[model samples]
Target: MIAFASFAQPPQDAIFPRHHPDVVDDMDVDLGEDDFERGYQRLTCPGEPITSSQAFMRGHGTYVDNEEVIASVAGTIERVNKLVTVRAVRSRYNPEVGDLVVGRITEVQPRRWKVDANSRQDAVLMLSSVNLPGGVQRRKLESDELQMRTFFEDGDLLVAEVQAFFADGAMSLHTRSLRYGKLRNGQLVTVPPALIRRLKSHFISLPCGVDLILGLNGYIWVSKHMSQSQQEGDAFDGEAVYSNRNDEIDGATRIAISRVSNIIRVFGAHFIPLTDTLLLEAYEWAVEQEGDVRDLLQEDVGDALVATVTAHN
Candidate 1:
């Protein structure tokens, strides 16, 4: 195993990260001439050794020469990535032009909802950003109060993608389509937003046969099925977990639910993002304490979410 060393600026630790202040989104602070020492940025680039002068996104993995961290925020290095990548989770960097994410609702205003988009300022969800379907005219009316239509009150959990950065460092979001509606019937969890990928907007699948659509701007929708054609896809021969044990039906159901939620919770958004070994390790670790999967994704995890889900269910 290679013992990768990570060097970074002190200010790089505050962006997008839940910890630290002064680290706003998309904002990059520079490193002075003596900011870094002589020759510590080893070459993970095959031949050229690169020393980390400023580090951001400290815990999540780092992408090599990829320019993702070009705008480093600040932080202490925790785990260095393998060659092309390093762990930079605790760092706070802003949402760029095209970054996808999963977030939790922290505050809801008169006509908007504020989300903790894994950033310093909570992302905004304007009434117009939401696409309310099945309205009287087969679409949402313009006069509808966005705040009431989506009902994304405080404490709700959502999955969203980043569209563009606001001049005030705020990111915008949308959820006006079927794929991005209110979540129901399953569980919701949060992870380091940096790990979320942008493929198809979302990819969360739970044990209850639910498919998820995560918005890059911080809106998330989850349901039992993706569509009519996929309805039968969840067909289980009495055991969704595929267990062949002779345990009681209820016991088996409980086990299956736990397994399903954990798998999606930890690996839902990562598609070719994390190493297979790391994913397996994560799954194993989650299983170790897996008892009631619902317990893991309850009000304890998202208080406002439980209320929203309960109201819908």
Candidate 2:
């Protein structure tokens, strides 16, 4: 049917870098022509060996040999037949059905909220799927179109599940489940879609108590939940220490800015597996910045972060 093989191995030094300290995190680990020039090798199809790299790239699918499968990103892995899927930490892979996801609202249709669910096309959020606070059954009343639409309008972030796939390639989504809904007071960290483990929604608690939403769909959200509003974002997975907000300027605001800013650096093909402790340390650093640099958080900090983590490791 579909042509897909597992991963394969190459010579040493040819071992493709799983996560490069300089590469932005959201990158695909493909054996491009340039990759060959860089001496990068295809390690495995889901961790399988490849005797011939060129032939394998000619559409010959490969799978991991035996059962030794290490995650490319630090996410959960799902063994679907001969193909093992990778889901990055904090995000889930968007499968046909029963997949939990954390998505950002990229656009708003008349009655649907267009969500970027870490895929090529944006998933639709129909008016009927949301669960209002009253439990009165959300019915998208007449006034809702004019008023509430702005509330969940474009740019609103949500955590949902793939309710069903439409015949037209688009997928229907629902947030009625408790574990599925809006994500609040959390930092959205985007990594290469491959880093995540597949098939399950795991809430990983970092060594520093940071809550990580590992979606099988390839989107991860990491943040500290200790604070009533927002916790002290640190640089490591060390213990939580209190500090003076006044001395640090816009404490929580800067942290929010920094956390969201870090997303761009990691949401690509070139990414690494971040440990729970490392994630916590980064969070702490974001919360304690000051001055005009407050807005500097939006920049892609992935390169620098990668370098720092690499040096430490």
Predicted structure with the largest TM-score when compared to the true one: 2
Q: Looking at model 1, which ten-residue stretch has the lowest summed lDDT?
A: 235-244
* Model 2 CA deviation exceeding 4 Å by range: 1-94, 207-209, 226-270, 274-313
- lDDT for residue 224 in candidate 2, whole number 0-100: 50
Instruction: Write down the RMSD of candidate 1 (Cα, Å).
Output: 15.0
lDDT of each: 0.45, 0.52
- Give per-residue lDDT, candidate 1, residue 152: 59
TM-score each candidate.
0.47, 0.50
- Candidate 2 lDDT tens digits, 227-297: 32332232121222111122232465544544533532342323555445555555554434442333323
Model 1 ranges off by over 4 Å: 1-89, 135-143, 146-150, 197-201, 204-254, 263-313
In candidate 2 the C-alpha lDDT for residue 137 amounts to 55
Which lDDT value does model 1 have at 75? 29
